[model samples]
Target: MSILSALTLSRRPATGFVIVGIFWGGFAAHVPVLKAQLGASDALFGLLLLGTAAGLVSSMWLAPRLDRTLGARGMQVAALALALAWLFPGHMSVQVLFFVSLIFVGGASGLLDVTMNARVSDLEAQTGRSLMNANHAIFSVAYAVAALISGVTREAGIPPGWVFTGFSVVTILLLPVLRMAPAAVEPEVGYAGAYPLWPILLSGLVVLVAFMSEATVEAWSALHVERTLGGGAVQGALGPTMLGITMAVGRFSGQVVAERLREVPVIVGASLLSACGVILAAVAPVPALAYIGFGIFGLGVSVVAPMGLALVGKLVAPHLRTEAISRAAVMGFSGFFFAPVFMGLVSELFGLRAAFGGVALLALCAVPLALALGRYPLRTAQIRP
Candidate 1:
């Protein structure tokens, strides 16, 4: 199927991806300023980020039921909640208030994340087309655009509050696109049976590793460029902007690749390539080299999580789709919030370079997990276009 067709089929979830991308891209670009405003040590900041983790865990438990309760309106509700939640953190100066704000941010984001991903899986099952990569590509595109805007705004001395507020308004403005037909209710009876654990676990691990690398870079690449490599604000912002651009290229490329290649080899090759990118960034002597590394890393890692989530959707029974995805997402999406903490602690104890080197090691760990996923007898008939 062509990209336009895939997007038309999956536009609702695609909007959710764009909303998430805009918020995070702006947040990533403004991290240095946000950190400075709070007067947080690296370790303390990492600890504070744990609030997001906590909220993520709670959202995972609540998402399936909430999705069921909200039905077709779930994405819109979650998006609005996320927009409201994001408004607080940028304005917060107190560490305690900032931490509390993150919990709400994480919870709202986690809800939207699970809802949109599961919606993509549902659309894929109904249409028998590869849509995840395409939808996620939209996210990367939005992220790159938002990061670039945030970079320019920061250089002009705009406060984080106004920046976040602008994005939130954009999010609210975009909500109409998320509307969809009411879902056919599945009986809740059979869903309580045991989900196949091994597939969920393995796929979740693959996503976890991919997002750990991604999260670390998104949260710290700017700092690495500025503090470690002695670049200025706009240059530091370029770090994530480069990553977002390359990731958009990679995921859009993957949408085409999925038509021709099996998922396993693609994932394994991407993992190895991402490992190289992270290692290069870790040892880079200057900001330009680090940007090259981040671009490479972004290209390789962009497809891993989407592919891993697709794997789970393919492997599980139809009745178990939402729950299995929520569980897998909880495991996978936690890495998004968790890696910042890991990066912060590592950067504190060692250095940003060393912390990024550790991310390289984490990227390599996905290889074996993908191999294990290949062992499962995927319902090949279901996934073919």
Candidate 2:
């Protein structure tokens, strides 16, 4: 299908994911600007980020319950909340306010993340099609574009707050777009049933490993290229930049293949691909080779989380779908939460190559987890919108 047709087929979740991508992409690029504006040290900013992680984890825990209570409206409110909360960080003058604002920002984002995934899962059930990967690909695209623009604007000396304020309008526009979506039905599965605990747990672990691997490369690839391989700044930038581009491409490819292939093989193949990429990067003698490995790693590991979540959506009782997803999301977010520390500790003890090798080992772990998940029985009755 054409891109426009695919997007039109899945407009609601697509818009939500893209908006999130834009918000975060801008936030990522403008972080240094925000820190400079507030005059915070690296240690202080690190602590403030910890607050964001805490809020995100806490909100992941809360999202299912919130969804149960508010149904479809919860997603709309959470998306808007994420946009509004995003505006606070760039404008904060006080350290305390900056930290507090991030808490709410993370909370809102976590909520929106889970809700959107749940809705996409519901949509999948309704349509009998695979959409998780395409939805996520749009997110990456928005993130890339927004980050690039943020960089350009920063170079031109635009204030971070004004940039973010302008971006917030994108989320606000989503309010009307989402409102125009067909009215939501009561989920075919009711909310009071017991979730299949072990299957969800295993699936969540797979997601955790996937995210951890991706975050490791994203956080440390440049340093690995520069410090380890003695590459110049431009070459160093190429590591993460290529990884980001390949990740989006890989995910888009996953969307194309997700429906054609069974979930287990896709998960296993992607994990192994990521494993090879990281391992190759670990052993590369030159910066150029390492960049290739990082790109390979990005392409291979890209499909892991989306496939896992899609599986969880298929396996769980409809009533408990949101909760199951939130549980897995918390696990996935934990990877994002600890990846820096994990990379730092490993690099400190064994060096960057060893740290990346360790990431390779982590990626390998997902293969078995994916196999284990394949043993779970899917629900006989599917939920449809």
Candidate 3:
């Protein structure tokens, strides 16, 4: 393909999707460290994450309407505000700063979540191909990079606040994309009605399971390794490295193969792959085996969320697809933000091993939802655009 064609393929939502993944992926890598540094208990951590998801859910309903009033760039600016606001949580005393910061972080992450999807919805309309998986692959790579950077920073004895602050500065890259993107014009004359909520909700449920599984790995794998498996902290941290690498590979390549498959079979195949991976990883006799398990798990789930998200991009009415996508995404976000806390609780209650088993179980949890999404593939789903 020519450079112009590649650029065209990547423009609009595809570009924003990558940036969105990179920024949030950084935030994701820090959860383990954040929990450790704050000395937060499991239930508290879950609640804090839930608060963030609450913010995202609220933004989902508001984003498309706001898009109508302000255009895509306007929505992007609102999201930018929230991303900046997330930095304060890291510096707070566990007693005071943590909860307050959690609220801000969740809200900001949530806002960005909705706005970016909205941007991608429009961009997909223009680009006319399945870009979601590739974009999420960008997120996986960024997530791995972010986790690695955080590991290095932790080694340097930097606190979470400083790490987040650095990311905040890096967030300035978002401004140019927001500025250069054109405003949404009126849609094709036939556009009408909001996206039916049930299908989107079901799709959201699918993501909720997949992301929850992912967050379980990202947030707690290190703890599981060091505390449960009797491994070094740094060595323990490699779970996400493996997961991210596998996810990136699967998703980047999955996007190509996904173009050849329909929604259901791909999701079913990927879900089964992830479910099996998690069971093997979680039950592995040793840490190395567990690492391999996580890699397989990553490959299994890597495609689930992006493919679901791509469905979101195609399903709803043009004006409302972003809103619909956000709604679906908030469910997944809730799953992600909530899963760590639940795992922490499981660790607190049973053991880290069993808690991880909970994560493994969700792979199966996702299968039903993925099948649900697949069942109704014709429910207004257009091609990726």
Candidate 4:
């Protein structure tokens, strides 16, 4: 294939990442509107958010089978499902209906997450390239862009329903773009067989820690700035904004080094830096210092999930890659599910500072796991190039 063809094929997965980022960024900006629409208190809103995690975790169980059966088509189908579900939440007036809508939305996100990663990993295996960090970097950049735009529109008094409608249209428009690339095929095996459970569990553990640390910052950093440091709303918003910008920069840097550096050192160094960042945030005397800490934290944690996923991709046999990734995603995303709740509970008991300290601890937990993953030799498979 020519260079143009390869570049086009590579872009398909990155486009999916951008769409996912748009949903999440817009969703974050719209949370206040949804709360007002439903008149939900803090506890009630947390429960409603929990439904998404429940749906996400539950749907992950089926994602592997879906991908296995449909191959690349599974990603397109899930993205469509996510896009359609995206529009429903904006229209929901009843609490029950809204809760149910989130379930569908989360389920689609879960499936799309697994399918897209599997597809990207397949593409990397086929091309002998390091694509995961670059794809994830695009995700971070899209997220930052969407959040900034949504913030502006929210300030202009735009209804979230209108914003969501735009997202739906864009998502649908991207379907043909997703279909531009040929489907990735599972590499042939001598006989159909099961993948070993250990690698999945180990890699999944690292992902869980990485995601939990990241989610803690995203969910609570603003609160930490406002409540703990007595900052104004503008200062509070800077918390996540700084983190997002630094995260994009970090992942972009990772894209350049991913192929050259071994996964272990990358993960180990990133985790340690993330741990120190959270610790600094936990101890910072002022909001400005906390912002710097969060920036450091974002920079450190940015490359972790991509590196872990790439390592898992390298470890598994090609034919079994989808299944292994599904298992790992289930573990990884559980952190996304529970991290905020965990932080909330800790904050309630000990205060937000201690809660952030707990996040730093979680980052440190990944260090040993990264070392273990380093010990596993990469398995070579015959794949298309």
Candidate 5:
């Protein structure tokens, strides 16, 4: 399907993606300020972010059930929750409180993440169109826009609290568009079948690796530009802005690529390209070169998680899609939270450059996981006598 058609088919979920992206992009651009406010060392800051990891894991586990219970209003409820949750972190100056605030932020984000992705998968199944990449591209576009705006706000000396509050209002305003259609009922099968654990596990692992690499950049690229390369606040914000913009371009291109290429080859090639980009970013001596590296990395890694999630939807039974996706998301989304900790510890010991190198290594690991997916059997054993 064309990108426009795919977007239209999954517009509600796409809006959810945009909401999530806007919050994260703005937060990412403000990471330097947040860390400074807490007076946190790299190690301590990483540990604090573990609060988010805890919340994300717990909420993701509950997502399928929550989605079922909320039905058509799932997205709206989740979005509103996230809007409120984000308000705490920016307003907090205490380390403990900041950590606590992240927990709420992470939980709300995880809830929305699973719900929206599942919604997109449902649309893809219903329409027989590959919509995952298109919907995710909307997220990348929104993220880039938010990052730029946040940068401008930061330059104007606006505090993160007001910036977050503004974005929260924007999210609340979009609530109406997040209403989903009622999910169609599935036909009952004669016997309960074993869940397709293998595909979900494999796809989840691929997504985990992809997100780990992606998150490392989102969380630390600004620091790399500002502290490591001696850039100003606007320049630091540009780090993630560059990544978001390139990722949008990459994901939009991936929509077309998905129509023509096999999944395994595409993932494998993209992983290698991302690895190269990370290595270059790690080694770059100047902010401009680092931006180039980030751009290249964003272009390559943009499609990996979306494709991984799409693979799970394609491999699992329709009746189990929501549960399967929730399980996979728990695994995948953990990477998003854990990565900051990983980078922080590494940065504390070795420096941001070495931490980025570690990310490059993580990117390369996706190749083998993608190959495993290629060899896995296609027939999902959804039922057994």
Candidate 6:
């Protein structure tokens, strides 16, 4: 491999996430097209989204076994299938094609979701460093670009024709990217025995709360700006944009610090910052402070998930690390998936501001979890699988 390609492959999690970012960006962009094609209600659109949630959950059931059998090569293949799945339905009716593609993308995403983290865990062994947060930050960058492209195209009056045509180009590009990954097990340096589930479950609980706050900001930050702070709705949309920008910056910097300051304090400090930001934003009588608060919260969450994943990666053995990751991932996914409903119920009872801002409380709760994680920080020598 060229030195550049080798350096690139060294960043396995980021490389894996490149494929993920493009699809996620494009699929979200494609949602309107699906709506146009299916003539479906917003309610039905939500139901269709359920398929993705189902696929994600379902993959957890099989991911452990798949990881055991196929290793990293299997993950590479899964990435390929995920990229290609978007290329389907060339000849089908729009509605049928929309649903089919969604299901395919969901399954493909689920597989990648489980396997890539496992590979990150594996790569950490070789490098003996905490790099997973940097990898995830790269994914966020890709998603930002994707979302930007989609929005620009729509605003420019470009037809959805560009969606398939452009995204197909990304798929073709990812094939070369996936083809060059390092093998998973040429030189396993740590234990490969069965992993204890208790720590993993604890990790999952932490992930769940972390994700709950993350999801809330993602979906409701703007609404909070408009409804509570009396901002123009257009101004409100900037919440996640600011959040994303700050978060991308924070995660990139945090990865550098992951080796220097240690993950535990970085995480606990981050959680506290996030919680404070949300609470400030929630109570702010003006839109500007709310935006500032969202920015801080985004920066805080930037490292928590990746740090959590790195911890899981560090604790387990090689063959079983993949399962350990997905186990935690499943719980986190459930938390994010259910957060919206919980918000809705809370909104009905209290108000959108109260319900939406409650996510700050989730971040506040993560403070102790972050500290507890320090008590059992994953040792570098023990990372495998």
TM-score of each: 0.95, 0.84, 0.87, 0.89, 0.96, 0.79
Q: In candidate 6, what residue range of length 10 has the lowest lDDT sum?
A: 1-10
Q: What is the lDDT of candidate 3?
A: 0.68
Error of 6 at 115 (Å): 1.6
Global lDDT of each candidate? 0.89, 0.78, 0.68, 0.79, 0.89, 0.66
Global fold similarity of model 1 (TM-score): 0.95
* 162-268: candidate 4 lDDT, tens digit per residue: 88888888999998766533344546656564665777888999889988888778766766787799975456656776777888888878877776788889999
Candidate 2 lDDT over 1-385, as tens digits, reads 7344556767887878888778776765665566567786544554556657777889999887787777657768888888889888888888888879988888988888888888788777777778888888787777667766766776777888888888888788777665322224355534565558897899899889997787677656766777789975445556666676677888889988886888898999998899999999999999989978988998898889888888887788766677788899898877866765667667766788998999999999998898998887777435545
How many clashing residue pairs, candidate 5? 0
Count of backbone collisions within predicted model 6? 2
Error of 3 at 314 (Å): 2.8
Give the local distance difference test score of model 4.
0.79
lDDT of 6 by residue, 258-309 (tens): 7778767888889888888888777778888887887888788888888887
State the lDDT of candidate 1 residue by residue for 1-385, as single tens digits: 5777888889999999999999989989998999999999888877888777778778987999999888878999999999999999999999999999999988998999999998898888777789999999999999988998999999999999999999999999999888754344244444464558999999999989998789889988998999999999999999999999999999999999987787889999999999999999999999999999999999999999999998888887776777888888899877856797889889999999999999999999999999999998765323222
The sequence of per-residue lDDT tens digits that candidate 5 reaches over residues 1-385 is: 4989889878899999999999989988999999999999988988888888888889999999899899989999999999999988987889999989999999999999999998888877776667888888899999999998999999999999999999899999999999995457364467376778889999999999998899889989998999999999999999999999999999999999987886788899999999999899999999999999999999999999999998888787777888888888889988966798889989999999999999999999999999989976543333211
lDDT at 21 for candidate 3? Answer: 55
Candidate 1: minimum summed lDDT over ten consecutive residues — where? 181-190
**Model 6 vs truth, CA RMSD:** 4.8
The candidates, ranked best first by TM-score, are 5, 1, 4, 3, 2, 6
The parts of candidate 3 lying over 4 Å away from their true place are 1-8, 11-24, 27-29, 75-79, 180-195, 377-385
Candidate 1: stretches off by over 4 Å? 181-194, 380-385
- The order of the candidates by lDDT, greatest first, is 5, 1, 4, 2, 3, 6
